[model samples]
Target: MIEIKNLCHSLGGKLILNDINLTLPEGSIMGLVGINGAGKTTLLRLISGVYSADEGEIFCDGLPIGDEKARERLFFLPDDPYFTGHTTGKALFELYRVFYPDIDRKVFLEYMSEFKLDEKKPIRNFSKGMRRQLYIALALSVKPKYLLLDEAFDGLDPLARLSFKRAINQAAEEYGTTVIISSHSLRELEDFCDSYALIDKMTIASSGDIAERVNRYCKFQLAFFEDFSEQIFFGLPVISLEKTGRFARIVLEGKEDDMKKALEKLSPAIVEQMPMDFEEMFIREVEGRGYKV
Candidate 1:
């Protein structure tokens, strides 16, 4: 497990993260989200010990951050991983093995073959997606207890995305790899991540199980037989309402059955509950926190 307590950080005298606290359990995949410049990268860096926090503490399985023992159990993959122009895939793997002595070279070779990558070729000569595949292979080889990925799926094609997702899920299931991924691809995150931590206002503004949060509220599309105005839903607990002629779409705060009963109280020609995926739920949540997007 990873525990962050009252964590604070700043860069060049400007605060990035402030008094933030989070707990990520073992074998869980967590999605970290926010708008650009919301300090998503900063938070991940702090957790991975790339940048030490200015205050508070972070621990992994009871060991403090940066401890050699704790460090050995985790891997941090930045958005743009650094590699020299002449660094081949095999050389990179060897160098990583020096630090991660438990790295499985067989698994690494399998992944390299699965991705159809040429290990003899320098990483600098690989395409963007190819480079991502190389790093992913490296990550899987280490098989760390905690894997922190930043912009994990930036340049992969659709098929590569599926492969990466499969590999990640397999690792999580087999090795109990706890992953905290920061990405702009919310839909991709929605597909695999069971929980989420949303960054806003220099702190963790919201965090919870994704499914529970999405099901907490629902959207209903209603069409009234007679003429109806916005005043018709005046007393109801509506988070948002939009109108188009006699048709209306409203997001109400309640369970499906409860919302249905409430809507039934007002006779409508047609009413259907709409489904909200994780992305929509996240948008509403962050918007509630005064985030423009």
Candidate 2:
């Protein structure tokens, strides 16, 4: 398990994150999400020990994150992983082996083959997606207990994205690896992550099971025989409302039955509840904070 308590950090005299706390159990996948510069990457860097916190502490499996033993159990994959122009895929594996002595050559080769990458080819010759594939193979081969990936799905086509998801899922299931991935692709994250943390205004605005969080918001489409002003929904817990003529679509925050009952009071000819996905939930969340989304 990973524990972050009262974590605070700053750069260039400006505070980036403040008083953040989070707990991630073993073998769980979490999506780290936020608007640009919301400190998502900064938080991940702190947890991975690339940058020490200015306050508080971080722990991994009861060991302080600054400890060598704790660091050995985690792998941090940045959005732009470093590789020299002359480095080959096989050479990259060797480089990782220097730090991770137990790195599995067989696993590396297997994943490389699966990803259709040439081990002997210089990394400079590979495309962005291919380099990402190579590094993912290395990550799996390292077999770290904690995996941190930033912008994990960037530069990948649909097919590559599927392959990457499959590899990550297999690793988590077989090795009980704890995974935290940061990405702008909320739709993909929705399908892949079991839980999520939303970072906003230099802190975690919300964090929990994705399904439960999404379930809290109910969406409905209504039609009325006569035109009605939008103020008719004044008392209801409306997150967003779009009205045109006698038809309106709305999202409300509450139990499904309760929200339906409240909307029924407005006497609409049609009151149809609709499914709310994670992307919609995220949009509503930020919008609630006065963001024009």
Number of the top-ranking candidate, with lDDT as the measure: 2
RMSD of each: 1.3, 1.0
Tens digits of lDDT, candidate 2, 1-293: 99999999999999999899999999989999999999999999999999999998999999999999999999999999988899999898888889999999999999999999999999999999999999999999999999999999999889989989998999999998899999999999998799999999889999999999999999999999999999999988899999999999999999999999998988899999998999999999999988998
lDDT of 1 by residue, 29-65 (tens): 9999988898999998988999989999999999999
Candidate number with greatest TM-score? 2
Cα lDDT over the full model 1: 0.92
lDDT of each: 0.92, 0.94
How many angstroms is residue 192 displaced in model 1 relative to the true structure, after the best TM-score fit?
1.2
Alpha carbon lDDT at 198, candidate 2? 95
